[model samples]
Each structure stands twice: as C-alpha cells, then as structure tokens.
Target: MNKDSTQTALLWIVAAGFFMQALDTTIVNTALPSIAHSLGVRPLVMQWAIVAYTLTMATLTPASGWLADRFGTRRVYFTAILIFVLGSVCCASSHTLGQLVIARVLQGIGGSMLLPIGRLAVLRSVSGEQYVSALAMISVAGQVGPIVGPTLGGWFVEAISWHWIFLINVPIGVVGLFAVHRYLPRATSTAAPRFDLTGCALLSLCMIAFSLAVDAPSQSHRAAWSTGLFALGLVSALAYVPYARSRRNPLFKLSLFREPNFSVGLIGNLVCRIGSSAVPFLVPLLLQLQLGYAPLQSGLMMLPAALSGTLAKRWIAPLIRRFGYDTFLLVNTLIVGGSIVAFALITPSTPAIVAIVVLIVFGAANSMQFAAMNSVTLKGLSHEDAGGGNSLFSMVQMLAMGLGVSISGTLVKLFSDQWGSAIFGFRMSFVCVGGITLVAALIFRQIKETPPAIASPAKPAVAGGR
Candidate 1:
C-alpha cells in the first residue's frame, strides 16, 4: 500500500481505539442501575465506577507525550490495549461495587493513553495542512460513541447481561492491539530529556485526591475527610504550577498557557463542558428515578441526544464562521444552559413525545457546543505546539467529566434532601446544573477575536459519520 493509504489505515485504527474508550465510558451510565441492583448498592454511589476511570485518565494524560517520546508510540499503544482488555475482563467478573471501582482504575490505566498516543501518532505522520481533517476525523468517534453507547449497553443488559457490557470491549480491544502493532511506527528519539518522576507523582496524587473529593457523598459521614482530601489536592495541584514553571523538563509544561487562545480554550473547554457533560448523567436518572422508566427505556431516551448531536456537528463551523467565535460561543452556551434548565419542566405528565422533542434539541445544542468550542480552541495551535496542547486539552476534558458527574450526583443528593421528594429531587438538580452552565457563559467574554478560516483540503465526515 502507498504511504497515504497506510496512514489512513492508521487513522481508522486509532479512531476505533478512541471510539472504544469513549463508548465504554458512557455506555455504563445507563447500565448503572442494573449493575447497582446486581451488586446490591445504592445506584447513586455507582458514579464512582465512572469517576475512578476518568480520574485516572486525568492523572495519566500528562505522561502520554513524555512516554511516547521516551519509548515509542507503538509499544505504549499496545500495552494500553492489553491493560484495557484485562481491566474489562475483571469488570465483567466483578462481584461488588468496591471490586468494580478497582476494575475501573485498572481499565483507566489502559484507557488514559489511547487518544493522546493515537493522536500523537497521527500528528507525527500527517501533514500540517491535514491536521484539522485528522483531528475532526478522530473527534467524530467521540461524538458517535455517546449516541451508540447507552442504546448498546441497554440492549446488552436486556438480551444478555450487564457483564456483557464490559465483555464487549475485549474483542474490539483485541482487534485494536493487533492493528496498532502492525501499523504504528517507532519514533526515533534524538537526545532524550529526563522524565520528571517527582512532578508526575505529585500531579497524580493531586488529581486522585481532587477526584475522590468531588465524588464523595455530601451527607456521608466521611464528608470531613473529603474536605481535607480536597484541600490537600488543591495544595498539591497548586504546588505543581510553580515547580513546573521552574523546571526545564517538567512533566507538564506551564509554558503552553502562554498563547492566549490555547490558554482560554483549555479553561473555557473545561468550564463549558461541566454543565453540558453532566446532562447525560442527570437525564437518565430523571427518567429512571422520576418517571419510573425501565433500564432499557431510559437508555433508549438518550438516543435523540446522540442522534441530534451527530446531526448538529455539520452546522457548527458555518455558524461559527458567520457569528465569529466569541459570539457563537456566548450564544450557544446560553442555549445549552437554557436547555439544561428546561429539563426541570419534564414530568410524567409532559407526554413522551414532547419529552423526546426537548431532549433532541438539548442533544443538538450540546453537540454544537462541543464542536464549536473544540474547533475554536484548536484553531490557533501550531504544529509543534499541538502535542502539549492536545494532551492538556484531553486531560482537562476528562477532568471536567469527573467533576461534572460529581457535581451532578452532589446536587441530586442535596436537592433530594431539601425537598424530601424524588420529583423535586430531580427538579432542583436540573436548576443547579443548568445554572452552572449559565454562570460559565461569563468565561467566554475573555476571548478577543476570531481567526481567518484555515480550511482543510480533505473534507472530514460530519457528526453522524454520514
């Protein structure tokens, strides 16, 4: 095969890896209740199963580039697939929530590497002119995963079992392992810089502590310990900034923040995503808990969000081109926030048709929000700058996911307590999570202007991949 054909094959392989990672992460959200019942735990606490994986992703993402630079993407990528497959096996066999959380951590150790290393492989192999096309191609998997995940997981739980949800990953990961080994290239290290073990350890501790604190139960007797852990997390996280700024070969280079767009984009991506990301978590509960829907039905309700999100990605660039980045982000953020608040109005009496319509709009807007923000944030990054920026952005994305889930779980708990009714429980949760999105709209005010379109030569597929 020609070089271009070989590279395209690599892109597809890496994209599949990313899709599996994202699908496995989201597919479980709807399956949580079933898993909870089987394991005999409160469904609310099952968020840790997800929290552990995302927290590990946030912690390990910083080391991705450094590892690739040290060992070679080919080796690291294979190891990641192996570890993920092992984790999946363990997850399928898990007997308890505690065991499940540990399995997620093991799953995380494998998953945390997929996107960055795969993207790095693409970044090294592709031309600068095609970077946008490559990124857009890979990001399409992320969007599609959500659309398919819940439905697929639900089907598995219904026709087979929840264990099948994890068992499913094994075959996909197996194919990925073989494909990556054959297609991935070894990066020739010119004089290697020393890896910063100290900084990596410190950051890992900070991320772990912070994520645990976020996931901690609000009314649990362990609340005080959660507070202390969060405080320690903050101190360690803060300590990394100056220490990174001082070192030549720091694990995370603080200097990446020097570019205004990259800096604002990363932060803005995290904040904007918190509210939007939490919706997938909140909506299923509102359906299953409040509306008394079955696991299969609740999971099916997520279809519109996925479908509309896929469809809406096509219009994002044109909309941004017309309104400019600042204007598009501001307005879209409001729409996404308003849509979240709108969920508070959903009830059993609202009529199933009306409810589906509302969710479709919400999914479309949220999908647009993701596509718009990702393109805007990445629009200005240079080729050399892409590695660290991409790594940082990926880390922040996963971090926000954990935080968003934590916040959603906490709000539901807090609201349920305040109102003493499950109906009001979800109602209050909707308002708070929606309000968080509205508050984040202020962050975009910092963006100064938009850049000229650096259009790709090859057209990437739209959100739904059609």
Candidate 2:
C-alpha cells in the first residue's frame, strides 16, 4: 500500500478498536436486565459486572502508556485485541453472575488499553500537522459507538439473545487483529523510564478499595467489610501523598495539583460525573424494569440524548468563548444536574414526549459540560506536565464512572429495601445522585474566568465523557 493508504488503513484499524471499546461500555447497560434474568440475579445487583469492568480499566489505564512503549505498539495493540476478544467470549459463555463479573474484569483489562495504545500508535505514525485530524476521525468512531450501542444492544436482546451483544465483537476483533498486524507501524523501541510500580499499585488499590466499598451494600452481610474497605481506600489514598512527595519520579507528580484550574476541574469532573454517569445505567433500568418498555423501546429512548449531545458539541466553544469557563461550567453543571433530577419525575404515566425533551436537555448540557470541563482541566497544564496530567485525568474519569454506578446501585438497593417500591427507589436514587452533581457546581465556581483567546482549544465530545 502507498503511504496515504497505510495511514488510512491504520486510522480505520484504530477507529474500529475504539468503536469496539466504546460500544461495549454502553451496550451492556441495555442488556443488563436480560443478562440478570439469565443468571438468576436481580438487575440492580448486577452492577458489579459494570463496576468490575470500569474499575479494572481505571486500575490498569495508567500503565498502558508504559506497556506500549516498553513493548512495541503493534504487539501490545494486537494482544489487547486478543485479550478483549477472549474476554468477550468468556462474557457470552458466563453461566452465573460471578462468572460474568470475572469475565468483565478480563475484558476491562483489554478494553482499557485499546484507545490509549491506539492513540499512541497514531501519534507516532502521523505527522504533527495531521495528528489532530487523525484523532478527530478516530474520535468520531468513538462517538458513533455510544449513539448506536444501547439500541443495538436492545435489538440483540429482543431480536436474538443478549449474548450476541458481546458475540458481535468477535468478528470485529478477528479482522482487527489481522489489520493491526499488517498496517500498524512497528516503531523503534526506546528505553522507557523505570515505571513507578509502587505508586501505581498504591493508587490502583485505593480506587479498587473505594469502588468495592461503594458496591458493598449490594452484597449481603458486607457492612463491616464495607467500612473496612473504605478505611483502606482512604489510607491508601493518603499514603500516596507522602510517598509521591518523597519519590524522585512518582507515577504522577504532586505538583500537577498546584494548577488551580486543574485541581478544580479534576475534582468537579469526578463529582459532577458521578450524577451524570449514573443516568446511562439507571435510565435503561427505569424504562424496561419500571415503565414496562421492551428492550428495544428502552434502547431507542436513549437516541434523543445521544443525538442532542452530538448536536450540542458545536455550541460549546462559542458558549465558553462568550461566558468563559467558570460561568459556562457553573451554569451548565446545574443544567446537567437539574436534568438528572428531572428524571425522578419519569414514571409510567409521564408523557413520552416529556421524557424525550428531558433527555434532549440533559444530553446537550452534559455534552457541553464534558467539552468545557476537559478543556479547562487540561488547559492549565504546562507542556511538560500535559502528558502526565492527561493520563491521571483519564484514570479519574474511569474511576468516577465506576464509583457512579456503584453508588447508584447501592442507593437503589437501599431505597428499595427501605420503601418496598422499586419506582420510589429509582426516584430517590435520581434525586440523590442529582444532588451530588449539584454540589459539584460549587467546585466549578473555584475556576477563574479566562478571556476567550486564553481559553484552551475545545476537545471533541468524548464518548460517555471518559
């Protein structure tokens, strides 16, 4: 193939991998109830499956860059696909919830590396001038994945079986494996710096412990265990502070937090996302389990949110330009949080049109929120610190996602048990998560307004904002 052809092929290969990863993220939410039925578990309790995958990704994502550089990108990318495909097969064959959760962990291991490694490959292969455009094309694939994921997952569950949602990845992975081997460049390996294994382990443990603590309520006889895990997570997080401070080359520098916007943005991203992230997981359950909608109908209901989010991207730059980051994020965070709270009003008798309008509003606000949040969080980092800051930011994004689902599931179970009504439980969960988001708006208030010229370049709307 010619040079252009190679680059084009490489782009498609990476885009396909990104699509597969992004697809699996949202697709499984729609299929959760079906899978729960097959596994003889409650749909709400099945969040461990989601939590395991996301938390595993969060745990491993920090290491992907080092792994790619240490090993060749093509080799690591190929292995990632293989592991992901193998994990997908395991997921399809799971006979129990335990088995499914284990498989998801395996899948998360691979899913975690797909995008980061693929992006690294693109960065090494493409020229500086084309880098942004190349990433833009690949990001389009990521965006399209979530747009179709829920609906496709629902269609598969209704039309065939839930397993097909995972089975679909097999063929894509098989083709990708060959294409990656053939098309991806084998960049010369450089001696990578010694990885901060201790720091990474400590941070990963903190995230795992915290996530498990949030998830503990869903499991029977785990109150004591939950308290212990929360304590462990806290200790581990605190331990990292002194450890990183002492280390010559920590996994992430403590100095990164000194950037006022970075600190504010990062915390706001985690807190605000906790509420918004729960929406995707909770909405499908609301439609199918409560409203008596079919799987396909529930999935189709998500289209308004997805489409509106896409349309809202264009407005982010201009809005940030006009109002600046502080005001944009402040106002938009409330809109996003308010939209989530509005979901509490969506009972069976609620008009479908009203629900659709809410989804549209939530989608637009949430999209702008992500674009603005990401830009502000990243804009303050110096060129030297940008790479580490981004990696840390990405890790937090995944952690927040897992934390959101874990908290939402726990809240649902708690409220339902207390009130003896699933609908009320769902309503309370929405209100609580929305309240959590509302609180984050105060964090965004810390951001100092910058002139339009000084604002960071807008990032493409990240799929699911992670």
Candidate 3:
C-alpha cells in the first residue's frame, strides 16, 4: 500500500482515541440527571463528577508531554487507554456521588494523555508538510465527539441505563488497544528533560483545590473546605509564575505566554467558552429540570446543534481565507454571542421549529469559533515551540472548560436565588455568557490581519507510511 494510506490509517486511529476521550467528557454532562437519580444526588449539584474529571486532566496534562518524550509514545498512549477503561469500570459501579467523583479523577488522569500523546505520535511520524492536515483531521474527529456526546448519552439513558453510558467505552477501549498495538509508531526523544516534581505538585494542588472549592456547594456540604480550597488554589497557581521564572524549566512553562496572538487566543477561547461550553450541559439540565422534557425529547432537541456544527466545518477554511483571523473572530464572536442571547428568549411556548433553528445556528457558529481559535493559536509556532505550546494550550482548554462551568453555575445559582425564579436565572446566565463572548471579540481585535501560518504546504499523494 502507499504512504498516504498508511498515514491516513495512523491518523484515524489517533483520532479515534481523541474521540473517545472527548466523548466521555460531554456525554456524562447530559446524563447527569438520570445518573444523579440513580446515585441519589440532586441534579443541580452533580457538577463535581464533571469537575473532578476535568480538574484531574488539567493537573496531569503538563506532565503528559514529558512522559511521552521520556517513555515511548505507544507505551504511554496504551497505558492511558488502560487507565481510562479501569476508571470507567469503577465509575459504572459507583453507588455514591463521592465514589463516582473518585472514579472520575482516575478517568481524568488517563484522559489527560490521550489527545496530546496521540497528536505527538502523529507529529513525530509524519513529514513536516503533513502536520497541519494531520492536526486538522484529528481536530475534526475530536470536534465530532463533543457534538454527539450529549445526544448519545441521553439516548443511552432513555433506552437502557446510565451505567451503560460507561459500559459502552469497554468495547471501544478494546478496539483502541489493538489499533495502537498494530499501527502506532513507538517513539521517544533521546534527550528527555528532567521531570519537575515541585512544579507539578503546585499545579496539581491549584487545579484540585480550585475545582473542589468551586464545586463544593454541589458536592459535599463542606462550606469551610470550599473556602480553604479556593484560597489554596489561588496561591498554588500564582506561586508557579515566580517559580517558573526562577527555574530553568517549569512544569507549566511560562514562556508560552510571550506570544501575543497565542496569549489573546487562549484567553478568548477560555472566556468565550464560558458561554459556549456551558450551553450543552445547561441545555440538558433545563430540559429535564424546568421544562420536564423526557430524556428522548431532550436528545432529539440536541441533534440540530451537533449535526449542524459538523456540517459547518466545510465553510471554516474559506471564511478564514476571506476575512482573516481578526475580522473572522470579531464578527463571528458577535454572531455566536447573539445566538446565545436568542436562547434567553426561549419559553415553554416557543415553537420547536424556532428552537431547532436557533440551536443549528449556534452550533455552526460555535464550530467555526473552535476551528478558527485553535488554528490561530498554533499556526504561528515554530517546530521547537509546538510541543510545549500545544500542551499548555490543551491544558488551558480543559481547565477553562471546568472553570467556566463552575463559574457559570455559581452565577446562575446566585441570580436564581435573588430573583426567586429558575427561568430568570437561566435568562441572566445566557445574557451573561453572551456578554463574555462580546468581550472576547475585543481580544481577537488585537491580532493583525495576516494569513495564519501553516507548517508546510501539502504535497502530491504518494504510497506507504513515512
């Protein structure tokens, strides 16, 4: 067979791993109400299951690149799969919210490595010319999982049971194990950097403390611990800046912030995501919680968003080519923010057709944002900086996903309590989320209008894996 086919196979395998990891994150968000009922917890208070996983992943992500660089990529990649499956089994069997949270931590520990290691494998295996295409392919797969996860999770809950949501991962894990064994290149760097344990500990503490503190009201009733954790988290995260300055190499790597485009892009992604990311979680909650929609109806309502996002990928490149990153992000950020505002207008009496159209537009615009921001962030990096920069970027993405939800939930709770109306709470939340997006558009405005820098031009097709 030819090189392109072999490389395509490898990319697909890597993308499969990514899809599994991302799918788990979003799938559980929608199924939380069902799972909470089974586990005997309040649906409003189940964010910890989500936060624990995301926080653990954020803490562990910095170390993944180092692990893959030291150990072979295939070794670490397979290890992640094994750990994730074990975590899933534990999660499926949990009888209490606490047990599920612990299990999710284990799952996050494993999930932290999946995308970075898989992407590392692809980067090391392919020629420089193929890096953008390879990454684009993987990004597309990663994107699809997030889109379908909610609807699929709801379907599973409605059709079978919540436990099956995790059980399904078993077969996919088995498949990934074999794919990695057969097709993955086992590679390691010769000059491995020393592991920075101190930095790692500080960052881990930062993530864990902040995450638990934020989710504390919803988790256990430990108000004191929540305050203490939030304090510790701030200190832990802040301490790293100076430590990174003093040391030769720090775990989180401060050098990445030096690039203006990257800095702004990362912030925009995190803040804007506060609006976009919470919707998937909140939409399902709204359906089951206030509207009393059945799981099946909720899932069906969700289909328009996911599918339209997938379809919208076709237009992203041309949009980027036409408007450039600055204009594209600015105009589209407003579009995204406005679509979210439209959700505030939703009432029980709102037509299903109107809701579906709104969701489709929101999902498409959100997908465009993902493709644009992600591409813009990494597009300028040199080969030497790509490894560390991308790893940090990924960490920020996960961290913000967790934090955004935490912050939004907190805001919603505060507003809901004051107004004494759940619908008012949701309305304010949507407006607040849109306001954040509008603010993010200003960040992208800082970027000069230039074509995004891709690694290398694509070559004519040839046969065999490089």
Which predicted model would earn the best TM-score?
2
- Model 2 gets an lDDT of 0.89
Cα lDDT tens digits for candidate 1, 1-466: 6888878988888898889888987899888888989999877778889888988888887787677778788888888889999999999999999999999999999888887788778878999888878887888787778878998888888889999999998999989888887777656654557778889788778877877786655566679889999999899989999898888877767767766877777778777777877888888777887788877898899998888888887787788778887888888889988988889999888888878887898888888777666666665766566556665676777888888888888778767767787778778777887888887678876776876342232332122221
The CA lDDT of each predicted structure is: 0.79, 0.89, 0.78
Query: How well does candidate 3 score on lDDT at residue 170?
Result: 86
| TM-score of model number 1 | 0.91
lDDT of 3 by residue, 100-204 (tens): 989999999888888777877887789987787787787766777776787788889988988877887888888989988877775655568898999889877
Write the number of the candidate with greater lDDT, choosing between 1 and 2.
2
User: Candidate 3, which ten residues in sequence have the lowest lDDT sum?
Assistant: 457-466
Candidate 1 regions exceeding 4 Å error are 1-5, 126-136, 186-191, 218-221, 381-384, 452-466
Name model 3 segments beyond 4 Å from true. 1-9, 129-133, 186-191, 216-231, 452-466
The estimated TM-scores of all candidates read: 0.91, 0.97, 0.89
Superposed by TM-score, candidate 1 places the C-alpha of residue 406 at a distance from the truth, in angstroms, of: 0.9
Cα error, candidate 1, residue 411 (Å): 1.7
